[model samples]
Target: MTTVRLPLFPLNSVLFPGLVLPLNVFEERYRAMMRELLKTPEGEPRRFAVVAIRDGHEVASTAPGMPDPTAVPELGPTAGFGADPARAFHGVGCVADAATIRERSGGAFEVLATGTRRVRLLSVDATGPFLTAELELLPEEPGDGSGALSEGVLRAFRQYQKRLAGARERTLSPGTDLPDEPSVVSYLVAAAMMLDIPTKQRLLQAPDTASRLRDELRLLRSETAIIRHLPSLPAAELTRGPTSMN
Candidate 1:
């Protein structure tokens, strides 16, 4: 039963555990978050929750303590996107570990945060200098499954990667094989694919690692079929072998 109250960063991108992304913190609210987090001792957790936007964009605006007279975000689920905070954001999100927070010469901040784990937003409030939320840890249930299914998923993913590389005439997928952990592997694949917003969100909110893998496998096969039969691509554009559409 671990619960935390921390600042939130609502972006248009999804974060997955074991994967990291670079962020440019220019908003006054987030800049303040960086400053406060830096004050913590060396061993404390320096993190914030990242919720992907459902139907909005990230824009610079005013927050508490800032002298700027810009728009103040509403206090609710859509709160992060100037949304209601209660209805604007998804229920599940990822906690980003601020591995590095550097002050920029432009009065903003540059942060590198890696997704640490999944969390469910229980509530949010505007009672502080920044948007704060109470989130509880969401853990994946242990699944009993055979290795063969895992292997099949991997095979389909590799085939999909090869076809994509062929079309680009260059490699885009991972250079090395994914790890044995199903969750990690699924995220890695999702990151590489140019999936739509809804599909990516579904992957992020999957109940368990096995479920994530199965969904990824289906996507991989579907994509492979699309590329394999598209007559526009030159036969030489394939990386390894063309997948059979039938």
Candidate 2:
């Protein structure tokens, strides 16, 4: 297994491969991370690892009245690991490539990135200005019957979109066509569904394409049924798709 060290950006939400991730980099630690990434020569992939914070862990706010930014918890899972940065986050994460990094006023950054691949977090270093982690790039495996699973998932996904749109009184994507490739379908469905952080994280950590698709299939059916029975859902519950990170 190959291991490489890269900057880490912990978030409250899960990131799936191929999904778009936009970030507002205002925290000093993250701003420092952006500066370090900017030093990479143009044309090279400027990448970082994005790990989801475990439930009960919060990303510190930089608002004037909030807790001091320096007093924030280290970028790692806090529930079981305590102060161990390496064990602070879930084991699996997605590596993101920063396609655009724009500097805003006050040295902050507006970054537009895309999740490129899954990785296994090996260890985290918190002694730097920003968190950096040693990661093992995880290969995408097309497990047995993935092709067949893809078709079923696609059908369920369409139904899910329809049900969700009905709940929201609008088309979710109107005419957007979903991809047929198993891994693409899996990631697309995982990113599109209105699921909790733990559910999405599980999807991201699935052993293979077929496994992820299978879980998504079950979730879609359950969600579609719930939506069907409910007369209406709140606007927030109906919201789905890629979300921005701050």
Listing every candidate in turn, what is its Cα RMSD in Å to the true structure after a full C-alpha superposition?
A: 7.8, 3.8
Q: How far is 114's C-alpha from truth in model 1 (Å)?
A: 0.6
Give candidate 1 misplaced runs (Cα > 4 Å): 56-83, 167-177, 229-246
- Predicted structure with the largest lDDT when compared to the true one: 2
Spell out the clash pairs found in candidate 2: 76-88, 77-88, 77-89
- Residue-level lDDT of model 1, residues 1-246, one tens digit each, is 899987887666677787776777665676777898899799987989987656644332323223323433333223335545545567788998988999989868878878888898888776666777899999975354624546667778777766765655444345554676666766777666657767888988888877777888889999988977654443244322111100
Q: Highest TM-score among the candidates is held by which one?
A: 2
- Tell me the deviation in Å of residue 13 in model 2: 0.6
lDDT of 1 at 21: 63
lDDT, candidate 2, 71-184, per-residue tens: 433542232235776655788999999999999988879899999999999888877777889999999999999999998988887778677666454544536676879999
Worst ten-residue run, lDDT, model 1?
Answer: 237-246
